[model samples]
Target chain A: MKNFFVIIVLCLFISLQAFAGLHVVTTTTELAAIATEMGGVHAEVKSLIKGSQDPHYIEPKPSYASILNKADLFIAMGLSLEIGWVPSLLTQSRNAKIQRGHEGFIEPYQGIRILEIPSGVVDRSGGDIHPEGNPHYLMDPRNGVIVAKNIAQKMAELDPAHGDSYQKNYEIFAETMNHKIGEWQRVLSKHRGLKVVTHHQTFSYFADWLGVRVLDRIENKPGIPPSPGHMVDLIKLIKKESVPLVLLENYYDPKPSQKLAGETGVKVLTLPVSVNGVETVTTYAGLFDYIVTQIVGAQ
Target chain B: MFTARLMVVLFCLCLLFSPTLVLAKKKIPDQSSEGQVLLWKFNQTGNKALIPDISLIGIVSGAYFRDDPATVQWPNPTRTGFNLQAAELGIQSVVDPYIRADVFIHMLEDGLEVEEAFITTLTLPLNLQIRAGKFRARLGRENTQHLDQKHFADYSRLRRYFLGNEGLTDLGAELSVLLPVSWFSELSFDFMQGRNDVSFDSPRKQDFLYVGHWANSFNLTTNLTMQVGVSGAFGNNVTVRKLTQIYAGDLYLRWRPHERRGFKWETEYYYRSLEGAVATAKEGGVTTSMVYQFARRFEAGARFDAIGFPEDAFSQYQVSPILTFVATEFFRLRGQYNFLHTDGAGKKQHEAFLQLMFNMGPHGAHSF
Candidate 1:
């Protein structure tokens, strides 16, 4: 019994020692990328969902709760992006500091300009709609700036000792991202109002950022797979609109878009929508760079 | 006993209907969207965000068995035809920042029952949580879960033989503490009224069921996880000056590479000792299952269950193979075949079942 108690005390001490700095946990990799930029060694950051995985269908694994239990700050792209999984983890985490409405919990959608808010009766018939708004705002570089600033503000609030450091890091990030956004806009300037086809509505914010016109999505609804009738309609729409590109997320299957390309002879650009989605795209800014490069190459 | 059951039913009924009555007084505007309209109305109504998440799940099955109908279990499809197994109505809501309430009303062909009703504490310190009211004891991996949440369509023979038909569910208070460890470790203790007839039943009010569980899980790798748990329950028996003790151990291993594909293997073993005035009866059993998600929405699994040592006179073993297809998150279809053999009776039985389950309401998160 003495040995057992001694071992438990040792374990508790080791556990407490593990949190040497502010621990930040994010729901998606994009949020982790931004948090990392803002934290700048003052905070240790981890993401629950990898860039390769679809955020819509994450299982609330118990191991995630274990991670959340130790998190000093939890950030998510709110508007119910993680509505399916995050709530249960927050409750199971048993971390009073990271519960909803607490300072440790951050949802960075307050300053974002939301889109796709339904104006009529909303139900599952619309294929897993987010009644609040679209949650893929990070795809837009401008929104990335807003989220980075929000995360920096929250990190400084939680770790006031590193307040000046976080603010400095945020200004650096905002300046670099602003320059990159201008460069990307110039690169895609010729494609303004360019009609493109996509697999899902994941590119809504991205298209909104560049003045690109989305002809129609291969998926008839948000999450539902395309039907034969819908594919027929899309083919006619693409033909009539002279759509030049079919943009597909790297994580999605390319068969449907390939078939659409075969039907329309359009260039297909399978792009990474999140950081670390591909081997070369490791940073948040690199994600947009890769998308622009793919679009320019396809054109 | 009848009056007490009636009173509980009436209380649950009141909870189930009160939200609709409260929402009826406020009229929703015709032009506003459903999501914003509800929020607007809640703001207008002042402190009456009374609409809780309400969901209904219905399970129906068809079975064909080559065994005596009388020998079949209560929950398993007894008749060689279609069976309306169960319909469950779940009402859940966060009562406040500190508390969340969940109530499940089960409707069987025979009667209505309040399956579980409990309130869980949200803001308890020391990484602790408390649940009060009637709830299932977390004695083993599968006992606390509802039928729909289970991997298989039917309960394992070991659980049925050891924990009774309904399992270890009763009026109880459970306190769970998330231990300060690097991995996921949780310890829970439950205190309940000793009312289960099969395992514990005492007229004395002082006699209570006590249960303790220690669960620990480790992320062995990025794609693999393993969980191990041990649990024990003690209570007074129906006989004078008698006692009942039950012990259980469970293991779960999962390898999930991504959302679409994964494999899970789970095993649980249970031992029970019932003390009578004359002698003590001891028995033990084990159940093991493995499920593999081969495709996006399809899973195939098999389970093996045995309820006695080879030397025991009364021993039974069963083998089940199951296939499941999930049309969506809210709908599922499963087919299973069970082969059973009893050594004492020298009898062999075969059963096949096809089950359909559907759910509707706001998407509720499930425990891992």
Candidate 2:
């Protein structure tokens, strides 16, 4: 009986070591960054997409399959953002543990405010538009706080042994974001209700948060490249709105945007949408810093 | 009698539990407790008349086989065989917000053989999706659908000679993904084990069986809204002692210089090399097609295809015109006429078809 008890104690020790922490896999660098902060040393977080790469397009490498094949939790920006590769990878990776509807598949946006919900039918002809609205909600600092809180809550639920640590990390992130929000409000205070035009619909949430006025979009529609006729009309619209800036994401084709900017004599602000969008912007703080500096500098 | 017995059993069960479900529905008004069931209907009809020779007017029913449409006679429709081509049944609803699955089964009688029975998976995200069981191989754009579903009938001679008159399908799995660059592009990769659609279960040399191999293809349809992609596959036929390497690509552009009225121009080119005594050397081909759709309901298109084969004395070219009419949302009809010319020698083949198309609920492959 004593020997059996000893064996049981040893098994418990081994299981504790084995279950030391959960293995979490996030689809994008943004989620990975936040998860790293929340999980701290208790969990190992791996992001499938490089920070500089667009989260929308990930060439699923063999390594991703291997990671997904063993993940304890899978997190992503849903709303069809990762619609391109997430589903098939789940199936091909044969990781039923984190497949959709499984407790481990965390969309993260479940309770957050969703912007741009389309009221009518959406089709491909509309140019790569998301019917659910602009999914780049993480751009606004307020949304960032909500996302971090949710991530912390999820981490705590998933790892109650280290729940306190997760909560402490969440507080740190939330405090940091709240302070930055004040700084951003001051920086953006001058640009409130500032009229602007964008190359795409990427900045809807950012503009909403900053109280910036969007006169029109350069693409005419979300995914379609603006036609020559559309460009001519936009030039007129920009002049009419007296838009001061034509904002473009770093990765978009700049030819049309530049041409329109030149035609309207509006400053073209090429903003980095995410941390490490370029080699220069590599952290969450850096992402906000870059956007603020650029918009301020451009104005 | 067995079906009647089963129906009676189901009826009694419904009677016993129908009220309970109603009570549940009232209690959980959003219908979350009752769950959700969706239904859809679709069909298509049209006419085919070629000048100076052959023409026919017919209607094919069942785009998606919900219930079997009465079969139509053949030869009288198209010498190739059965006409009233497709009927389908589809159902899909989210088990919950995070989980959803759809099932589609199609039934078709080609007068010669029962042609279609298949299922597809449409719920993969990030453009990554896998289709298993039985479905069409992603060969050529035209080969992927039924005639009425196609912008035209009378596929290229190369498609006929190599892929066969019917498109390929068998027990297999396919994976597709979209690169997130905002470039509007997609890659569909497939791996399947199936014989050619033409000759089923035919015996061949070990090299031929080996050559009847698995294919890995990369298909990229650009977001220019034009589809321009190149895909290649290597095949090994152990029974016939032959290895085949094939590369094919198509450039497709749908330009609506004007909305509601537009022109679609598509060109497909292929190069195939089969390593064997009889199949040595390289064979290359190209097919260019142009279509004009009027009022979003009527379509007129034509294509020119050319190919070179060793067994043949020389290269061959075939030109054909395609016409289609949309009768309703779920139903469409189409017709085609082909003119084959081999090194100045010409022969004409005309064919017509009627197809009922039921688009049903949206079950779509991951868009690039």
Candidate 3:
């Protein structure tokens, strides 16, 4: 029986070679880039979330299921960032490797620090909210590096023949990121003390890293839309302070930010919070550089 | 034969055409945080093929025994030979950061050998929805495709009769939104109008009818969910007003000490006031069912339902015992025995049934 099993496995391996190159599926473009950077030529990576689309409200397209069905590995920013959509999508993949609890189901947060861990039971009372703090851990460069390493390790395990190549590529990528981080820090330091207002509380990590003071959010509550009274209060507060720029995400409807900026005489600078925020900012490094250039240029 | 072949051809076309629609433009999270896409579903491969988030399809098929073979129950059970119980396909995709659309197509028994189809789209941004075609109303949980997706093989007999298997589906439109509430609970209200399924004494062949349904649910710390809802419909026909007050409510709770396998208890009560129609009086019924899946691949369950019509002297009851075996990840074998007892009719009946279920893909997620 053991010999028979070995023969079947050998036949399967021969059939698998026809389907060689590793297929990587990711939930977001940022993670896709990391997998590509780590896997190099050994794997082809695809992102489920398009940079121009909302990560939270992605409708599982039939096309995504087809991609996942054949993919060898799946990576995501876990902690419910893709919560409402991922679970149902993954169930369609039928690949045991990419299923939850499998090594292929890689969550980069396993090695990084998590922020905004809610102390109480977090429900959807405040709109469709994630109970597990914020799932946007990728905003921080350090978290990005850690996630890249996780992807590299998983790729090495799946393809041992290319394990050495993956490690070398990861090391080079880390060193290159380290050098760029220093330059970004220097550029951001000049605007460290600047006070900024944002539409939502999505810039907690970026603000912490730059030491920028978040005066007030344009949104009245976490998920609540800005009311007339709240906007009036925000306008009063902005005029009272020496604020220069009001930060707004690229995906947000700019009318509200523009209206508030117009009232307070504040410049509404639409910033890319993640990769693909603009055609030029297509990678993680490009995203940070774009944000830094905008903030410092405003000065 | 042509229609059957047509359905198969459409299903295959959907499967083949899906792959060509690729994500050409690089996805930027910012562009999608606020979106305006209509409807979508992601299909994977194998039994898990499709978006895991909120997509589901179910079917229910059974035999109905009548007292007199001469008098046919207009819609209850006319003729049966492996009928197309239900054909539902839906997609609840998040289009942007803050918006998602819940859309579905329901094709079920409309009239004599007739199948109906409709689509419903629920948008979250404005707490409103735009519906087109035929869809089930929010009258009661059982009225919707609730029993069809059950882990057990049988449902309460009361649900089968008054709720009419396909429960309140017609060519119409409805708008509903969940309201903000305190604690772990949610509230929602619905109002709809169009082609109603309930028959009335209307001289006009087709008349616009109004329907209203309200639902509230609470979740406790002990992994228990309790929901209550009330629904009513009104038609313009002078005689139809007599059948206006149709109300129903259901309570369901499932306790899972462990995920994938657990125990569930469900109950439902239905009341219909048909002024001078068949048994033209008031009729109410209640059903209670208990299910337990203690081990992987095995399950055992039972149910008891009783009904009381104003014209009838005593209530009718039904008890069912269900057993299911999961032989593989994609298939399940279920067998059930239904014991029917009617006080007025001296006939005590029993039916033994077997059902083979092949899940097409990933099971859709239920709303929390």
Q: Could you say which candidate leads in TM-score?
A: 1
Error of 2 at B78 (Å): 11
**At residue A147, what lDDT does model 3 achieve?**
78
- lDDT by residue (A1-299, candidate 2, tens digit) is 99999997676434222435878898887778778888889888888766655666454443365567557778887777876577656654445457665446776764457787665776545656666667788888788777777777777766788989998998998898889889989988988999988887778888898998888888777655677898888888888878888888876667788898678787888887876677887667668888899889887
Candidate 1's displacement at residue B7, Å, is 28
The positional error of residue B200 in candidate 1, measured at the CA in angstroms, is 2.2
> What does candidate 3's lDDT look like per residue over B267-352, in tens digits?
77777665553445567788888889866568899988788844344578888888988654335677777777878677786666
Instruction: Count steric clashes of candidate 2.
Output: 56
> Model 1 residue B158 lDDT?
88
DockQ of each: 0.32, 0.03, 0.02
Tens-digit lDDT string for candidate 2 (B1-368):
34334434644553354322343343322323231110000011233111111112233532222222233322113334444543444433333322344344444453333233333332333334444445565665544554433565444666665566655555455555533322223456555553663322223422121112111222233111355566765445332545666677766666543223667787776676656555565777777888897854677888888887433445887777867776433346666666665665443333344443434333322222
Candidate with top lDDT is: 1
Candidate 1 vs candidate 3: the lDDT winner is 1
Q: In order, what lDDT does every prediction score? A: 0.83, 0.60, 0.61
Candidate 1 at residue B161, lDDT?
80
Q: Please list the residue runs of candidate 3 whose C-alpha ends up more than 4 Å from where it truly belongs after superposition.
A: A1-19, B1-368
Instruction: Report candidate 1's interface RMSD in Å.
Output: 7.3
Worst 10 residues of 3 chain A by lDDT: A11-20
Greater-lDDT candidate between 2 and 3: 3
Question: Which ten contiguous residues of candidate 2 chain B have the minimum total lDDT?
Answer: B35-44
Off by over 4 Å in 2: A1-21, A50-67, A120-128, B1-133, B136-159, B171-197, B201-368
